[model samples]
Target chain A: MRLLTALGQDIRFQFRHGFYYAYLVLTILYILSLRLLPESLVYPALIIILFTDICALGFFFIGAIVLLERGQNLTQSLFVTPLRLHEYLLAKILSFLLLSIVSAFLIMLGGSVGGQDLLWFIFGAIFSALIYTLFGLVFAARARHVNDYFVKSLGIGLLISLPILAYLGLFDTPLFYIFPTRATLILLDTLGGDYALSEKLYSVANLLIWFTILSAWVYQRFDRYVRHPV
Target chain B: MIRVTKLHFAYGSNSKDTLNGLNFHIDSGEVFGFLGPSGAGKSTTQKILIGILNNYRGTVFVNGLDLQKLTSDFYESIGVAFETPNLYTKFTALENLDFFAQFYAGETRNPNELLEAVGLKDAANTRVSDFSKGMKVRLNFCRSLLNNPKLIFLDEPTAGLDPVNLRKMETLILAEKARGNTICITTHDMHVADTLCDRVAFIVDGEVSLIDSPRQLKLQHGERFVDVEYRDGDSLKTKSIPMDKLGSNDTFQDILKNHYMETIHSREASLEDVFVKTTGRSLQ
Candidate 1:
């Protein structure tokens, strides 16, 4: 009950501060850009826009929220409550996940993309956002300023985007799967065509593994950050 | 409600200890002041008690539970008003309190009632960003009371308040005490410590030098003498005599019997004076 209340207030805060409206504007622009693109370019644009704007942007959103909360000493107040670290992290992840899901929906709708692919798009967007949001929590954990936070966020986003080259058929190395981005892109790719059951399972299992590791690391780093934050 | 023994804490591996081998305890319904100058570890100790800073080498027990062992539910029983106001700037004063009130499993006081008690009833609908420093402090002080905590921690509770708000805060604190709540306040302001604390500890450089009631400390460090002023012709004359035998002292009796007395006062030290004398440093 307390967790739900906290999440509700956080959502209300984000809405009242125009963060949700900003998300709305960004999502509409991405969808409209896809509509303007040539028919042949729409497929590749879908790949880039879905991964970069919908998935990776969630990282920046979480980073921005963390920095703002730190400035207001909101984390210090929340730390003293009955709210556990995981519960807090879950609340943040869920809030951003909702935005990511909406962004995915709008992109797919605008492109006339549907069928089982929509389910895959929604699922892939959620897990992708979760992975990057955890990464964002680590990046912004010790940040002292908004500029510093974005600088680190940009750096981490670049590192995570390495697998995008392989996803685009520019890099042929199988080792690219080590990064969760490759698995996420493959999941989205499979959703658009008929693929072997084993391949889909491989992508799902790989992303889940990465999610577990990232969640554990995020929990530890976030605990340290709130206990003795910069 | 709080017991700390050999409480030693340092910020980092290479940093010096902020609180070194400190020990103190407060009984139920007691108002104890942790008095110290800036950077003297008063806030650090309060943070440790409130579970903000952990990983210290010490034994702390608050409300009969070990500090290290206590979980988040422990916070449900205590309230904290930080030295700097920490309310959400975008939210109205009442909204901030109502939002925070939802976190507690226990019943909480009405946000408007708490604001009214602090004389900020009119600012209930105002955003915290628009409030003055005094107004923010008043709101912060009352937010801590929304939970109706048994133990409260206040850091510089009246730091930036005007005299009127300051008195209102003091009265509210006294009211809390009257209701049998334990308060542990951290402040360097002697007047605040003198007025609200039943007992105070003078801390300097992460160590305590003295701990006693304000009246007892004042009397212990005060001079046992009285100064007598009288009118002599067109001039005013003053004399100091030992207070032990003032009634029998010939000079004092002669002056009182023959001359018109102007003023007579015993030299009692203020809390600030005693703090400086005991610590060899002023409370800045």
Candidate 2:
């Protein structure tokens, strides 16, 4: 019940602060861009677009939200309440997930993309957004300002995107599986077409494992750097 | 309602402790103030009591619960107004209060009533970003009371208020105290400490030097004399008379009978004076 209340407030906060409106414009642009692509290129382009923009929107947006809250000293007021750290984090992730899922669904619909496994697409969207959101939180905790967050996140962003090279078959390696984005790309590829059952299981297992690891790490960093900074 | 013994804290491993062996207790329904300058461990101590920073090497008990063992429910009974106005600028004043009111499991005060009490009723629908510093301070104060908390922690509660608003905040604080709430205020404003606190602790160098009622502190530190300013034939003159025998003193009687007395004042030390004398440091 407490989590739901916090989530409601978070959603209201985002709505009032223009986050939903900004995403509305961005999502429409993505749908239009997808429609302009050739029918043969639409599926791959949509996958790439979803993986880069919608799934990763949480990464950039959560950083901005956290940093803005920090700058305004809102965290001090927030953590003082009965709301636990995990609930706060979950609300943030879920709120951003709402935006990501809505945008991804609209883009897919507008592009007339179909014949994909809906469950895999949902899982792909959720897990990918969760991973990136948690990753963003880790950096946001350490960032002193919005500019600092972006500069540091840009470096982390490039490192995480190295899996794209492996996805494009330019630098394929088993080592790429270590990055959560690798699992995200594999899961998102299911949206374009069916894959081997073993590959799907591997992708699911990889994302689940990464989610567990990142959850613990994100909790620790947020507790240390954001909640109880020395 | 609150107790601390040998409370010690430091920001980092290599740094010296910011709070050093502080001991104090606030009875329920008492208004306690932590009076100190910046970096004097006043805020550090309040943070510890409020469960914000818990890595302290001492024992703290609030409302009979150990600070370390406290859970989220502990917050339900406590409200804190931070030194800075840490509110959402994007939300309207009423919206901010309503948003925070949802966090409490128990009953909460009406947001409109709180806004009205803080003189923000007319601006309830205004976004906080449009609020001046004083207005934000008032709104921040209103949020702290939404839970109708039993124990309240106010940090520099009068930092940005004009005279009129400052008096309003003070009256509201006294009203809360009248309702039997224990309020712990941390501030360097001696006037506020004097006016609001039942007892204040003069904290300097991370240690409390004195803890007593403002009236008692003044009596103990102030000179036992009264100053009289009288107008002579051509000029004004002043005389200091010991307060102990003022009625029997011939000079005081003569001044009142022979000269037009302009003004008379008891030489009672202000809280600022007592703070300086006790802590050996200015509030600045």
- The number of the candidate with the highest TM-score is 2
How well docked is model 2, in DockQ terms? 0.76
Measured by DockQ, the strongest candidate is 2
Q: Per-residue lDDT tens digits of candidate 1, residues A27-56? A: 788788888989888887887887887877
Error (Å) of candidate 2 at residue B175 is: 0.3
For all candidates in order, the CA lDDT equals 0.85, 0.89
lDDT string, candidate 1, B1-284, tens digits: 78899999888664888888898888899899999889999998888999888888889999889888868898887988988888889899999998888888899988888988888899899999999999998888877887899999999999999999899999999999999999999998899999999999988999988989999999999999899999998999999999998899999999988999999999889999998888899888
Give the per-residue lDDT of model 2 (tens digit) for A1-230.
77898888889889988988998898888888878878888888887888888889888888889988888888889888888889988999899898898888888788788654777767877999988888899898878877888888879987987898877778988888788788778778877666888888888998999899999999999888777666
Q: How much of the true contact map at the interface does candidate 2 reproduce, as a fraction? A: 0.79
Q: What class would a CAPRI assessor give candidate 2's docking? A: medium
Query: Relative to the unseen true structure, what is the C-alpha lDDT of residue A165 in candidate 1, on a scale of 0 to 100?
Result: 89
Task: Give residue B4's lDDT in candidate 1 (0 to 100).
Answer: 90
* Residue A152 in model 2: lDDT: 89
